[model samples]
Target chain A: MKKVMLLIILIMMAIVFTACGGENESSSASENEVSIWVHTSDETPEGEAMQSTIDRFNEENEGTYSAKIEFIPRSGAGGGYEDKINAALTTDTLPDVITLDGPNTAAYAEAGMIAPIGDYITNKDDLLPSIIQQGTYDDQLYAVGYSESGVGIFYNKQMLEDAGIDLSTLPTVDQPWDWNQFMELSETLVNTYDTAAIDMAFDDKSEWLMYAFSPFLWSQGGNLVSEDGSTAEGHFNDENSVKAFSFIQEMVKEGYTTITPVEKGFHTGEYPMKFGGSWTIAEMEDYPDVEYGVMPYPTSPDTNELVSPSGSWQYAMASSSEKQEAAGALIDFMTSTESLTEVTLANSVLPAAHSVVEEVQDKVSPQMNVLIQQNQKSAHARPVLPNYPQVSRVFQQAVSDAAYYEENSDVQELLDDKTGQMEKALK
Target chain B: MNTNKRETLAAYSFLAPALILLGTFLVIPALMAIYYAFTDYYLLTPDQRQFVGLQNFIEIFKDPIFIQSLKNIVLFVAFVIPIQVGAALGLALLINKPRKGNIFFKVAYFSPVVLSLVVISVLWLYLLNPSEGLINSLLANIGIEAQPFLSSPKQAMLTIVFVSAWQGAGYQMLIFLAGLQNIPSTVYEAGKIDGVNKWQNFFYITLPLLKPTSVLIMITTLISAFKLIIQPMVMTQGGPMNSTMTPVYYIYQSGFSDRMIGYSSAMTVIFGIIIGIVTLLQSRLTKEDDI
Candidate 1:
């Protein structure tokens, strides 16, 4: 009984604390105060660096609106920040500024929960085109990014060297591998030393597998969202997508890739090359003995454009915000070159602002520049539809079903069925 | 002199707060959800909401993904109940043996019951991770091939059922334990004197007496197991091919992921109706006289 009462009291206190707006800025006569919430787990050094940046912003602002940042830390394995945001929305209280992912930004923006910040970012000439493209929701920008990450081929150089693969004449970004080049290399590299060229975990259950398989779809010009972003077209079962899928299927069949159920292609290091995002750079540095370099995801043989599945995070204002000035100012402070540089070095991602990119590149690991160069012509947000998370999930399941089907299936019919469901979901 | 009027007022006052809370949070939302299910409601974009009467339900029933999710849930309920119930019975039978350390054994087995679902899921995830996990290591030591417990579509559902049974059997075990203690020792002794074997005695006497306890455990567990969201959601995320996607998980996916609160609400209504009917059937079958 005492414990229950104590629990209720604790909950009540949390509600009250969450309700507390940062000490109201005492007008121009007093110190202006703004609250910011960074919705990432606290374990990362990047989050810590971000806190330091917030502290610096506070120190610099003095009596003007001093920006105060708080971390809304989450359990790393589930739900993420959607439930936290939902609770905040219900209470009609929100942080002055929030860092959100691209899909979530679209959902919140479409819901009228977020304010359009195109007016703020468009006027700034330093904004990068690809990053800005990702921040737009319903033809209006609601968020501005400081740093960006995109998928790339991170190869273990020592593994390549041991296999007698020459790096001196490696293809430049323009002359990079198409499907033919990729297959030839994947086959030869695997057979030459009997080492796995790529880790292809056949299981659809792993998050890493989903992340790994996405580039194949993107490389073939397939996408998660419809052209208008209102619906999801079943590109997973498309001809080009199937061709790419069949290639991976053949690799699994031929032993060119690591198809082990327990130990996957990359993390097991059975495969020297890993197709992952810039997020891997920080961890890659720990492998000091393994010489490695990052390159753009191979171009589609058909599209001829170097396409990469990129994802970004945005800082924006909540709809119920009464303190728009404070929110806007906080967002502005976070997006500034100083903060962007800190995030770039800490997170090992490419800076969003063009000017900031040039400055921060030298500060971060040298491998991170691959993201910056890749961002120039080959970047994309995964999908920004309100139904994107579900869409990806449903698509992943369909692809997995097709991949693991013991019997033959009508691929087109499967694709048609998924599209029909997506249409209904959009409706 | 005015005792009747004062009594009426007291009754009204006693009911008022509860009525208000129920009306606001429960009863009202339940009605509103039915209405929303017929509309094209988006939680984030309130303006996009428009009435489309029966369209959402049509869309859902016809949806292949939704159909797969439903099929998965049915399989899950069918698989988990037997596994969990059987395990619970076995545990009850074992622990019913009053030995020197029976109390300690009961406490050890029941410790998982007190743990939070999220904590248990995390612990299980680490313990089941194919490469470095303890279970895999133990299996490797025995020369058995490492299994993809949560990563293979064929294995994921069964693995989850096993984990769920492991976590939940203790609660049902306690009820079975009570039922076991209630059986008079004279019946077993009389059966022994009549030349009945131990197995025969259990089959005839113990089984008949434990029917009520079994029924009680079954009904409660059936209702509670339908709410299995936290485990699969946190662990597998209904993945490896929607093998773990239960109806409640689908409800969350639709309402939050798709932002079609109306469609999700329709799903909720359907869910409520299904549960309501199931409960009624269960009660009808397990009436006192029938026992």
Candidate 2:
């Protein structure tokens, strides 16, 4: 009996070893196939478009080089995709092709987790300058994006009419409203409508704060980090940045804006105007009764430079992938002009390639046209540095503090505190 | 082989699988966490790490946010434990005997315990919104001013504590109920023969008999309360002004979001030691009481 039991144990161990070895053999056999990881599942429109593009690539390539896609859920308790990606980075389980938020390109590249794909991009020159800027780290292109995103002020046409402001006379993108004029318009709208003049989405205490509000700092001739990307002391807490934040505080204190607004305030017609992104145009389609118009982000009164927030998700290559050629082929196909136009239109965002934008300019809605114009003229990408995530967090906290400012609150003091935090993180 | 030796061999064979699983999952990870605490390891580049000794620990001491998180969790534990335990004991006493509505009451009280913490937090967030919320709408109907329950820095932590206590009290109540049922009814009968009132019997008999149960509840609740993260994270995002930032939330942010694995591991080691010491002291004290 003991001999029989020992023989059975040996057989079981052999079976287990065979099963494990089978997995490795199958994976090596399919080495020509590339895998892509995306944030959204295939149920969404953008995800469907991406899958379609991948399917096309697979059909055309056949056995030469096929591609597969995996979707990670974008929302959860522990930071969702960001947390998963970080965990995957440590485990070296990253896919050959990965999509990351625009600002993460620099951090991923700096950590040597992703490889530079500049040479693999076929239409690098045709891509939007802002897209190129967002994907570049240390003068090398580490990622490529199919769609670009831009933000501007979306206003209610009826509210403007009630406030006796002529829509036709409103400043164009070439000559946008300055800070003083913007404030005057806001006051007029609030007084006439007896509601919030603008919804700045202060309740969204996430990356939205940095993405939507950084334009004001840039328009005022300040930045989150120095040009050399070494420090944030002078640039982040400078006089211009302080003034920009003070304007936000003053707007809240003067009742020109609501700090904690109901979500989708503009769509619900609770606010006359809101600082919104290109995605807002798609969302507004659900509220057909609410007629709206789009305008550029306001310029700083002191500088008169037009600045709008711009950046979007980009495709990257993992450094550990042995299938670089197949991965590059998949990326090239997905970011081609036709694919970009299809994905952008399906996703209801701006296209990253200039040629795609021009092709779809007439086909898109008027609001999309305004977004395209802004992207073409004045979109400025956020700071692309390895420490951008930490810097953005400190700036978000400062903005949140300033939004809750009291009578004796000082914007300069808040900025200085944030500057200290950012400097420490940089170290 | 002899019968005693064969029995010992059988016992060792029976325990092997469980021991292997525990060592792999729990013991190995804990040892790794301690080792990682002495290094400067970022999550994004785990292969590249440098020894930093006690630098992370020293830095955490000077880090204002970490200090604030410590204060926040201590305050949470101080507020949550008593309220949760007292509420649980009260419910257990009410339903100790066979009452007409006992089943309904038990189910109603324990419903929130079954719900996920994220769901409860989200439900409470909508209910506690400053404007256009069920709670505020009710307040408006009664001519009371709207309260910024989660938005206000002064009220956010207290609101989280109340919600957490409400959701957790039911589990403790069930434990207390089981303990209460185990007590001899003859003791209560003896108290009644002595002309002892209900309150007197509760204080002298029930309370004294429930000492072990209370110690168990206290230690478990204290340990769980120190790990407060979900409520504040879902509701407030540790905001308004970092008023609701707890140590566990800070650790998660540092380890996962910020990728500062070494700093986060150092915090975990320190927090683990504190929890271990507290648990040890409580067990010792309770054993002495039993003796």
In terms of docking quality, model 2 is medium
lDDT of 1 by residue, A81-135 (tens): 7667766776666776787876576677767788987665533677777677777
* Best candidate according to TM-score: 2
Q: How well is candidate 2 docked (DockQ)?
A: 0.56
lDDT of 1 by residue, B156-195 (tens): 8888888888999998989999999999999888888899
How well is each residue in B1-291 modelled by candidate 2, as lDDT tens digits? 699999999999999999999999999999999999999998888889999999999998899998898888888888999999999999999988797989999999889999999999989978887767898999999999999887778888988999999999999999999999988899989888999987898899999988888888989998999889999888888987888999999998888768788999999998898888878987888788682
The list of candidate 2 runs beyond 4 A from truth reads: A1-33, A59-65, A76-88, A91-93, B1-5, B141-143, B283-291
In terms of lDDT, the best-performing candidate is: 2
lDDT of 2: 0.88
Error of 1 at A293 (Å): 3.4
